[model samples]
Target: MTAAEAAADLAGGIIRPLFRSGLLVEAKGDASPVTEADRAAERALRAFLTERFPTHGIMGEEYGTERGDAEYLWVLDPIDGTRAFLTGRPLFGTLIGLLHKGQPVLGLIDQPVTRERWIGVAGQPTRFTSPMGGTAACRPCASLATAELSCTSPDIFDAAGTARFDRVRQAARRVTWGGDCYAYGLIALGLVDAVVEGTLKPWDWAALVPVIEGAGGRMTDWQGQALTLHSKGEVIAVGDAALLPEIVSLLS
Candidate 1:
């Protein structure tokens, strides 16, 4: 099976169960929520990669880094949006991305409760599948003027952030709240125009880069910098390239 397919299956099989089981959840030092499901999901993904793609390295959120020197690496966030998961919200998801020489080639975001899978590969079209087994070809909506905007949290922005966010909000036709990792998935599906967030880790944003860019959107830091694995979390993804300058201006 392809890497995208393998990731979907593994995430659904191993990670989804934990969401359903009501596993114990705890807080990390940063106050982010984590659960047994997160650990188990990463373990399952790591084991699968080891056996299937033995030479590939692995990096995950729950578990520390391993085999970092390999030519290819799989970055896993077994559960993104653990806070939503812990609160019984279905906005969380399992994220998997494959990087070749520090560049992402494939990405998969799976929402177990919703059964929504968004997948993308470099140089290919992004696609989304729903729980009822319907599939659709993804495309970024035409322009930002007609676009809808969204973010993980309004509080992500302080007074400065709030001002910047308001600028983008005013420019858009509509703005929706919540969806954490799921927001990026929506951007890939052409359902949302942009998603911005702050205070992110590598795992939080890594898997999302390819998915958004592959879907014919632009993914970058607020200042228009290329997002790297070592990037400090502030991100702005937009379907409309022309709108980016305006959005960036607000952040500036």
Candidate 2:
């Protein structure tokens, strides 16, 4: 909980002030936006993790990995939604996950501006702290036809991937776009039924596994296998565990 608290505090201290302040946005080689806020937030997180847990490795979105041979590793995506941040939308989140022997043991998703946080500790229920504090749990919705589906956007998919995603989208009751890591948080809160995304990174989806799982939901790769630090990046999450087979079938 110390690391999660530090992450939330760092987001509030370094990130919140930069929101909608017209921070300059630059493009990485992959054309993803990187603002000053993103860099600063990540730097602070990296610093804290290094100082507090010097032996653990650190992997971040802005700064690359800090190669360590420890049994534990810290993953950070200081700003999970740079596009949303650039557009002045509040759909972004700060993602922090601790991998113990390559499995996420603790994870957190914090929306600093909203002052909302969800912490997922392994083998325990996900805890939430919003303006109104409570725990997080996924509500059951076994039928795909009645599920509310969410994805970052349709443009992230390729021609073949798009065709597959279209099938999943069509199977759902409704689809919403542009929620980055916040969608998974919503799923944990029982506000969203399922979330499907293509081409995510380790830092992108690793933190979500424990959050989803702790909330009584299921998260996995498109093939429905468990997610690891080395998964192929295609992710599917369904609130109702029974819906997994059907969702995987559609995605596959």
Candidate 3:
């Protein structure tokens, strides 16, 4: 928790001001959009983790890996929903996660613009803050037929993956798009029922596991396997654990 808090503090502080600043965005080699906000926030996070946990490793979206030999590593995404951030949607999130020996044990999702946060610890219920400064929890969803689903965008997925996700979306009662990391937090808050996403990295989904599970939900790969630091990144977050088998079948 301490590790993620520090990173979130530094990154959130740097990112909030840049939200709708018309900052120039540059594309990475993968054609993904990046901005000064992403770079600056990640830099702040890496610096704090280096100073506070020198023995730990670090991997971030803007910065590459460091100290991979360490037993613990910090995975970060200073801004998880850059597309939304660019459009001034306030739907972007700052993600921070801790992996002990390659297993994610802690995670946080912070939306600085609204001052909303969801902290997920390995063995504890998720903690949340709303704009009004009060507690929040996920409501129960008895079945997928009444479930609401989300994805950052169907466009992020490849042809095969999109088809699989479409099946799940059709199975669910409703679907919404373009939320990124905020969608996972919504699931934790019981505002959304499930989130199925593909082609994610460790920094993208690692922190999400604890938050979803701790909120009386479940998170795993689409195959229904546990997510490790090395998982293939086809993720499924569902408030109702019983939906897994049927959802996985659709995705499969």
Candidate 4:
């Protein structure tokens, strides 16, 4: 937790100043956006982690990998939602995750602009605090018909994935879009019931597992299997565990 907190502090310090400053945005080979804040925050985080745990492996969105074969690996996405940050939305966050032999065991989501943070450690309840005030608990919904659902964007889905996602969207009581990592945090706060997304990288969803599960929710692939480094990017997260089977069935 200390390491994750320090990483958040370092990343936030770099990110907060650049939001909406009209910084130059470049497109990566995949066409996703990148900015100086993302690169700088990640560089700072990598340096700290390297000094703090010299033998631990590190994988970052900005800078690829170092010591990838270590038993303890740190996964990072200094700015998880570059689009949101560029648009001056406080919904973007810094993600820091620790994987033990490829399984996530500790994670954090820090929204510096909103002063909101959520920490999740394996076998412990997720902790959350925000100046706006909310508890780190998920609300129960009797059925998908009553669930409030969110996805970062429908465009992330391919044709088949879109069909599957639409099945859940139609059954859900309401659907919200473009939440990015912030949507999963809402599930931890009991403000959102479920989120389904596709085309995610490990850094995109690794930290999310502990946060949601520690909040009495479940995070898994659409097939209902636990998420791991090797799993496909398709993901389904629900506040109510009972909802998992139904959601999996729908996606299947």
Candidate 5:
């Protein structure tokens, strides 16, 4: 199987079981909640990657980092929203991305509870598959004039995030709250027009980038900067090209 396919299968196999069994949850040093499920999921994914692509490097949230100078690296976020997952919300997901020469080339966000998977490659069309065997071709929103906007938390920005949030809210025709990584997944699915967030970690934003761009959306730092693995954690994603300039200008 291709790397992307293997990653997706690994994610599914890991998350599906914990989500079904209702595992116990706990917290990490950052105060972010974690569960046995989260660790198990990451371990499974790491083991799969190590065995299948032994030459590749790996970075994961729970286990810290492992290095391999090979041309390819795998980045994993076993459970993107442990807070939501612990609460039994279906918004949580498994995020996996492949970095080729330091640039993400493929990404997968699998919502095991929802049985929804959003998969894409850097230059490919984003595709969505549901548990019912239904599939859809996705693209970024085509119209800025009547676009919808979303974000993870209204509080990510502090004063700056609030200001940027206000600008986006004022510019968009509508705004919906409450979706973490799931918001970006919606953007990839062409269901949401844009998403703005702040104070994210690499694992938080890396996987979403390829999926969003592959779906024909634009993702950048708040200042309209290119998103790198070392970005400042602020992010803006838009489906409409025209809307981005306006959003950026207003945030500035």
Candidate 6:
């Protein structure tokens, strides 16, 4: 197994036992909910990465950055949807990503409860493994009017962002409210057509890039620029690259 896969397993093991166990929930400075599971899982992942990739840098949602200037860096979100996990919803996932020279070259999204994993590497087809069975190819989506659009939540957007999102929602044939990283995996699985979201941090999006792109999709900022470590976090991902021009126009 790859190190990313191992990291997902390690984090998932810590997380599964704590699911809906009524652990004390705390509020981070940003007011986001966090639990002991998130902290413990991240610590374990960090320890494993530090041992296995001694020279690579690490950036995690629960912990601060280390070796920030290293050419190769690992980005992790031990639990992408804390609310979903706290409520025993299985849609939450663990995200692991690797960046080389500031570009995301590898990404993995693992939904532990479902035992589904999506792995994407630069210049290669996205790979998916699940006992449930599915292909990793993106289904063709010709236009926004026929697309199934998804976003984690409307609450994450500001007034202006919400207005922009509403424009697309109005055009889409369907809209789903929450899935976080799991929804992105669905795009790789040919389930979801697109996801438009804003106010995301690096760890939140770093792992989604390769998965969508490698599966015959495209992920970029609302302005249509390629996503990078320095991106402003307005992400627009579509199963069909053809949808980008219309999506960008609507966002503008």
lDDT of 6: 0.92
* CA deviation > 4 Å runs, candidate 4: none
Q: What's the CA RMSD for each of the models?
A: 2.3, 1.1, 1.2, 0.7, 2.3, 0.9
Across 1-252, the per-residue lDDT of candidate 1 in tens digits comes to 276567668767876666646577677886777788788878888888888888888988988778887888888898888888877789988888888888878888888788887777888777777867644333545555788888888877778778877877887788899988898877766678888788777778778877787777888898988887777778988876666777788788
- Every model's TM-score: 0.89, 0.97, 0.96, 0.99, 0.89, 0.98
lDDT of candidate 2 over 130-187, digit per residue (tens) = 9977669899899889999999999888898899989889988999998999999999
Q: Ten residues in a row with the worst lDDT in model 3?
A: 130-139
Please give the distance, in angstroms, between residue 232's alpha carbon in candidate 1 and its true position after superposition: 1.8
lDDT (C-alpha, whole model) for all candidates = 0.78, 0.89, 0.88, 0.93, 0.78, 0.92
The TM-score, computed over Cα atoms with residue i paired to residue i, of candidate 3 is 0.96
What candidate 6 gets wrong by more than 4 Å, as runs, is none
Please tell me which model should have the higher lDDT, number 2 or number 4. 4
> Residue-wise lDDT of candidate 4 within 1-252, one digit each (tens)?
998898899889999989889899899999999999999999999999999999999999989989999999999999998999988988899999999999999999999888899999999999998888877998897589999999999899999999999999999999999878999999999989999999999999989999999999999999999988888899999999988998999999
Model 2 whole-model lDDT (C-alpha atoms):
0.89
Worst 10 residues of 1 by lDDT: 134-143
- Which of candidates 2 and 6 is the stronger one according to TM-score? 6
Instruction: Report lDDT (Cα) of residue 108, candidate 4.
Output: 97
Scored against the true structure, residue 145 in model 1 reaches a CA lDDT of 72
- In model 5, which regions exceed 4 Å deviation? 20-22, 68-70, 132-145
- Give the C-alpha miss distance for residue 103 in model 4, angstroms: 0.9
Report the lDDT tens digits of candidate 5 across residue range 28-101.
Answer: 78778788877888898888889988888888898977874668878889889887877767888888888888
**For each candidate, how many residue pairs have backbone atoms clashing (under 3 Å)?**
0, 0, 0, 0, 1, 0
